[model samples]
Target: MSHIHIPDGVMPIWFVLAGWAATAVILYFCMRRVRDVELGRKIPLIGIVSALMILGMTLDIIPIAYHINMSVIAGIVLGPALGFISIFIVDLIISMFGHGGVTVVGLNTLIVGTEAMLGFYFFRVFLGVFGAGRLSPGMSAALAAVLSLIISTCLMIGVVYISQINPERVLHVHKENPLGKIFSLEPEGENKRHKIEDKRIDIETFAKTVFSLGVFGWILEGVITGFVIRYVSRVRPDLVLSEVT
Candidate 1:
């Protein structure tokens, strides 16, 4: 529910490149951490988690209008470092199949990775603070899912405002492209696209739209994640918490 689907050519190059670089750095650290652990038995479990994430993403229970991503559940079960790597791998595989543009891979990785890490850490914290025995696994999973969506949404809103709404930057691009003809500074007598450009998107509008449509799906994701995590915790609690100290 938190993944960005801005499509190609919409986001600025700088934002995309920055996202890519950050993802690369995070992945490097994650790999180093995993290698240092020497958890040979967990390797197959990691692979299974990655495969499940890919399948979850590809299945799409809801249509495109409600874009749902189950990466948060993976993160909650897999821990942050492993979750980030798993999501990165899943996104890479999906990109090859043309599910999403290559240029946006970095952004996608960041968005989904953010969801995974937040869910994992928060769930751990929640369990530690409240005592896992006090709450059902389902509840923990749901909370983690909600936190993941909230964090991911904030990141995406920042990306959109920085890349799409800055007048100095957007104006420069408008002046250079054929899209300029369709979009202009004129207040009246302009086409629909031009009118949209004249208004410009502000943070409030961006937040409202993103959150309004997102909250329901996010809650639903939270419930599912909570149920799954709870089930896993009951069956194998060590599997979920062993890697992350």
Candidate 2:
């Protein structure tokens, strides 16, 4: 559910590039902060987590129209810095394999990384608020997953808006195409020809589609994150607290 499956050439170049630049900046800061930490031991764990996320995404549930990303689980286990890096690497590998477009890799990373970081922080906050109980961690993970999906959806809308809304340019392109005839139909007596060419991209329609497909998946993601976090809290609480203090 967390992985974006949208194809290449769908989103505008500027939107993709902007997402990449933002991701790069965030990664730079994350790396700088973690520079003093011991990364040798963490590298193997990162690889394992990345592989698990990839595998989880591949095991899609039919009829759901979504795939489990396991990004929140990674964030909960690995902490934010390493989790972000792990997700970035995973997205890069997936893009190379043509699972998603190469151009939108940064956007995809941002969406997945956002889920990871948010899940990590939310888990920590929930632990503090609920006294580190098993159930509390689980609740945190669930909330984080839902929030991450909402944020990613909004980012996707922005991409769609930028790509689809260009009145004058669209008109110019329509003038040069055979499809222009469809948009050039003359108006009848009482009814005006609905200008398909001039019709604005409906943001509400986009939001509705995203929300329809995403809401249920978000709930399922939350449940999975919650269960995993609860188990981790019981078996390996130290991993959860290592980055907090």
Candidate 3:
């Protein structure tokens, strides 16, 4: 639900390049962090986590039109570095399936990876604060999931806001290109006011339609995530309690 759905050419070239560069740097650090750990057993864990996230991401709750990410679950079980790696794999695979544009994979990974890292650290903090008594851990996990989703949703909207700073710059439309005329930011000399008014209405409608009810979506995902973490914690507390590599 928090992922970008824009097509390949929608984002400014500079922003896209920056996203890829940042993701590359982060991945380098992630790789280093996991390099010393023995992955023989963790290998299957990564695959399973990745598969679960893909399934979660692909299924949308029709009422709110929101989808689950299962990213925090990955972090709790796999730790941050490995969770981030798993997220990258999920994002890459989903993009190939047209979940999002191919060019936006880097940004998607960063947004979702941030959630995974936050979820792990916050869950740890909350677990300490709430203690390990029965349902207490589940509450902590829920709180962590809620907070992580909020932050990640804001980050997703921030990307949208930045990309839309200058519509023409984002779309990279050229006056000389005939096809670019369709995306011209300004209306022609006559009837410009009417065109501008219509465009404004459309933008407003899109914003409200997509972002107005965002809170409900996050809360719903948070609840589901908490239940999952709670069950997993009970069955295999080691996964939830493991230190991030």
Q: Please tell me which predicted candidate would have the highest TM-score against the true structure.
A: 3
lDDT of 2 by residue, 10-40 (tens): 4544566777998899889878877888888
96: Cα error in model 2, Å: 2.2
lDDT of 3 at 71: 90
Better of 1 and 3 by lDDT: 3
Q: How many residue pairs clash in each candidate?
A: 3, 1, 0
lDDT of 1: 0.73
Evaluated against the true structure, the overall lDDT of model 3 is 0.78
Q: 2 or 3, which is superior by TM-score?
A: 3
Once fitted onto the true fold, the runs of candidate 3 whose alpha carbons sit more than 4 angstroms away are 63-65, 175-210
Put down candidate 1 lDDT per residue, 57-109, tens digits, no spaces. Answer: 67756675454577877786677888898888888888887777787889889
Model 3 clash pairs are none
Predicted model with the maximum lDDT: 3
Ranking by lDDT: 3, 1, 2
lDDT of each: 0.73, 0.72, 0.78
